[model samples]
Target chain A: MNPTVNNLAFSTTFNAAGARYRGIVLSANVGIMRDLAFNASYNIQSAAYIGIPQDILLQNTNLLDGGQITGIPLRQGTAGLSYQQRSGFAARIDTTYVGSNNSWNRNPFWFANASVSQTSGRVSVGLGVYNLVNSAAQQYGLIGAGVFVPQNYYGGGAFGGPTSAIQPGTEEYGLPFRQYWLTTKVSI
Target chain B: MYHNHGYLLSDDFASAKNDVGFGYTWLHQANTNGQFPYILCNGNTQNVFGTYPPLSLATASYFARDTWMPNDKFSAFATVWVQRSLNTISTHFDPRLSLVFRPTTNDVIRLTSGRAYSEPDPSLLTPAPPSYGSPTSVNCPSTTTGSGALVAIASEADPNLLPETANDVELAYGHRFNFSTSIQADAYQSWENQALLSGNVPISSIAQITVPQHLIAINIFSA
Candidate 1:
């Protein structure tokens, strides 16, 4: 239609006109020593700027909800400390941060996964906790633009207050907090 | 004032005796997995289920611009506005300096400069079909599945989407006649960034969106 381009309203992988995006990637890193270090990498994306089916996500709500993808912040940051003791053992503890997660897109999460590894003989074992902060960051969503207001409501009744002539459900569902996890691995 | 036009008068503004007020915002930008988790669809763009970005956006705002008139020849202006909510209301301190060049007793040249946040029109943010009271509705083309992705109309909200931020520069000229009626025309241009947009992605069946508590999006300048 002739609607103005305002919200990134459409879906990705299948976005419409104003939704076209030329995706990109970003990687963040740091080190306290050498091999005993910590690093993180994230996928930077906008949308299907130069394709067609890529525009579907922007048009169909059912697809956006089930497609396992959406417009989110592909951030995975880490903060940890690792060490090596030559013939003894190697250990490490790291903190990771991921923001802008959505539910319908299979990405409602921004958690921390810390770990510690030890190498004794030919095998190396490690364990760590994830979302250790104990956060229930739920990923949720709502209809994009089909809210029916009851006329008398002050906000216009949809979802999200900005347009809701009614003042209800201001704090909708969608969490960008941390959840915990446990991980382990062995090396030979 | 910082937020309420009178709140900028003190340091600890909460319980001040003045007319100043207070406000707050979550200031949390969408980082990952939301209504449409920003898929690393590519390099410069992100896809939610797989959509696209927009070209330009249009918006409307209701704000009380502060005005400092140091007499009549010189005056100043600034404003603190809240678009989304009481919690999201911020002092978008738009401080402006103007010169009242009165070539004739009935004419004046006004030069104004300041930063402005062009908020989305309530109509745009509210999820309505393509049209209003009119019986017409924005419908998908008759084409079911054919050529390239021609339509990209998402049925959800892009909350992380931010209100367009721009440096508003306005040059206005006002003229008043003996009849006390004045007509003013403003020539303006905005150097803008972080503008919000919505594009229709050519999805085969549907699209996904995140709309919970009105998602609050902000741009944090890291120095």
Candidate 2:
């Protein structure tokens, strides 16, 4: 058999395209008491491609394969309550819920944040806590061979076959499970 | 006809406050060469390699606005905008109307409606054509195996993309309970068409391995 006769090659390309995003956001803020206030918001979004190549296999039925448009969470929400006093004291606790998103096979996760601050004349001191739950979530990933070189025509080193293994595309990870920091500000 | 405030109709027209303004805006993309740099496996550019696309384009818009306030109780405002671009929809017209009504010292109502258009991203407006490279076998430094074979890849650009447009209307009401407390509520609805996004395209395996075949590939790069 002639190696040149059976040479089979494959490549990938992108085109300027269009997609649709439809959704509604509802938010509310209310006073629980003279010194306490509560606020929350919820967003519901549906996205689809106006025009997609019909040949590509659909990885996600709920979302358009190429049109899924990464980084957009279908459902996400945050709620928080705050308390303040005239004597220069304030505190707040808030929780965020990120619905399961397919941007990079990321699962749903919830995290809470809290902060306390006190102000005296020209100085203010505060402390904050992030990712109270400490959940390890993957925010994004790449779908292709795992190598980091120029291979095949697409740009990265080639994998064993057409269906290459998926790998992490970025250095971004889910919010740190639990982290704390202290902050102080002075205005003179 | 006689006026209730003892003012003639001509006097009312003369006393109304009126204002007019005109403005111009220009946006240009600094790069137009539409060149994508890719790494070549060997001396031959046809061998498999890496690539990145750069973008370039420009647009301009002109607008005029007019406001008429006959009295403190009510006012009317209108604006018209015309935008020109290099996209498929080269020209677009957008207009807006606003009405304000004050029934009491602490109560106010506002109604607004408008049509707006957003051009596609400059990067997406002009895409470089796809390139081809021949498969070459090479040694692998990272993998346990001593050698590997590189495959072919291709990309496609769309020049016929359209701009996104929306029609919106909103109603708002505000009331003041006291000097330090107030509440505001607004409800709005918008309809949009031709929104832009990234999607996968179908291409043949031959197109990727062959030399310079126009093909569309699945977007494997992540953000």
Candidate 3:
């Protein structure tokens, strides 16, 4: 059937027309002295919705054009330092930061990690700790779309409400808590 | 999901200044949801949901690539891909090109541009056919609502769905300060089209139900 693309109302999956993403990434590593080293990396990115799905746009009153895409961080950075000795001992520490995205304008969050290793002969052992500071970082998604109220539902029927009562369209993921691991390697 | 069968053949040719390769592949796949109830109308007990028949798809792909290093300081790589979906009567052609230059012993620059396409999930291509809840009968109680009242609910599949696609370009540079130190930077931009997502289509858009239906059908995004 040759139904208008926007008016063919059937619950189904379809393709969105347009989106754009642009970003810069930088990373570096340096050897400071005979036993010390340093490294860092930073990334900045931006995403925009150039066009909205025709059906969704028609169902909602608000427009999302030129708005930041949901679920993407705008900035991220990491820095690390390491120390090593000829005696087969090494240790390293690292920290990471992540900025908020278009959905929410909250403060940035960060976490740290540390690890140490010792190698003797053919056998070696190591210990590592992740989320060293136990930071409680969280991620959020986009707001819910406004509910569509047909003209017939104005006085009767059971379906009508403000969109504010609905939750965000996506789930929130919490960063993992602090954890530790011990590793060993043996050469045959 | 249905079973798949396919095969691939490839060959590579290498020389002092160039490396080339070619390959071909064929695949067949299918899917079904068996049977499950999707809607209940007027407090009826019997399952009124219906299901769709199994669906299958076949595809053939061919690709060729080559890397040429004309000298120690410059190189270029290119590849081309052609894919055809048999049942869908669709074909896609994708191409990529990359260039690399080493102006110094410890410094390098690279640039790349490409277009890529991803097929939709097989399950999404074969959702259960649309069905309407059973009407009021002797097996169920009837309220003041009109008789033969029905509410349509369905998980639909579109055979005409197209693959998602993206076009991207990237530039990068790297430098080494010593045997143990190095740095790199990159800039990139991309445009994506035909990204797929689940959405709702009010039944009112397709037909009108005279009776007030109390049950709201949830749109299932997963199996």
Off by over 4 Å in 2: A1-25, A32-36, A44-76, A83-91, A99-109, A115-129, A135-176, A179-188, B1-17, B28-57, B69-76, B86-89, B101-110, B129-156, B172-186, B204-223
In the predicted model 3, the residue pairs found to clash are B2-B30
Per-residue alpha-carbon lDDT of model 3 for A1-188, expressed as tens digits?
12223322345666755668899999999999889999999999877656765545444322244555544678889999999989999999999887775223334678899999999998889999999978754443324432222211221121243344342223334557778989999989
Q: Proportion of native contacts found in each model?
A: 0.11, 0.11, 0.55
Which is superior by TM-score, 2 or 3?
A: 3
Tens digits of per-residue lDDT, candidate 3, B154-179, equal 44565567787889999999999998
Report iRMS (Å) of candidate 1.
Answer: 19.6
Worst ten in a row by lDDT for model 2 chain A: A146-155
lDDT for each residue of candidate 2 in A1-188, tens digit (9 for 90 to 100): 12231122223323323455555666666777788888787776665455544332221112244343445677888899999999999999998878755333455667788999999999999999887666653344334422222122222322433333443232234554478989999998
The per-model lDDT (C-alpha) reads 0.39, 0.56, 0.67
TM-score of each candidate?
0.30, 0.56, 0.65
Descending-TM-score candidate ranking: 3, 2, 1
DockQ (Cα-based) for each candidate: 0.05, 0.12, 0.30
Q: Write the per-residue lDDT of candidate 1 for residues A1-188, one digit (tens) a residue.
A: 34333322243221122222222333333444555554444444333222223333323322232222334444434455666677756666655455453332333344455556566665666665555564444455434422221121112221232444232222334444454334444543
Fill in the DockQ of model 3.
Answer: 0.30
Count clashing residue pairs in model 2.
13
Residue B36 CA displacement from its true place in model 1, Å: 29
Worst 10 residues of 1 chain A by lDDT: A149-158
Residue B120's lDDT within candidate 2 is 67
- Candidate 1: misplaced stretches above 4 Å? A1-188, B1-72, B78-93, B120-148, B152-154, B180-183, B202-223
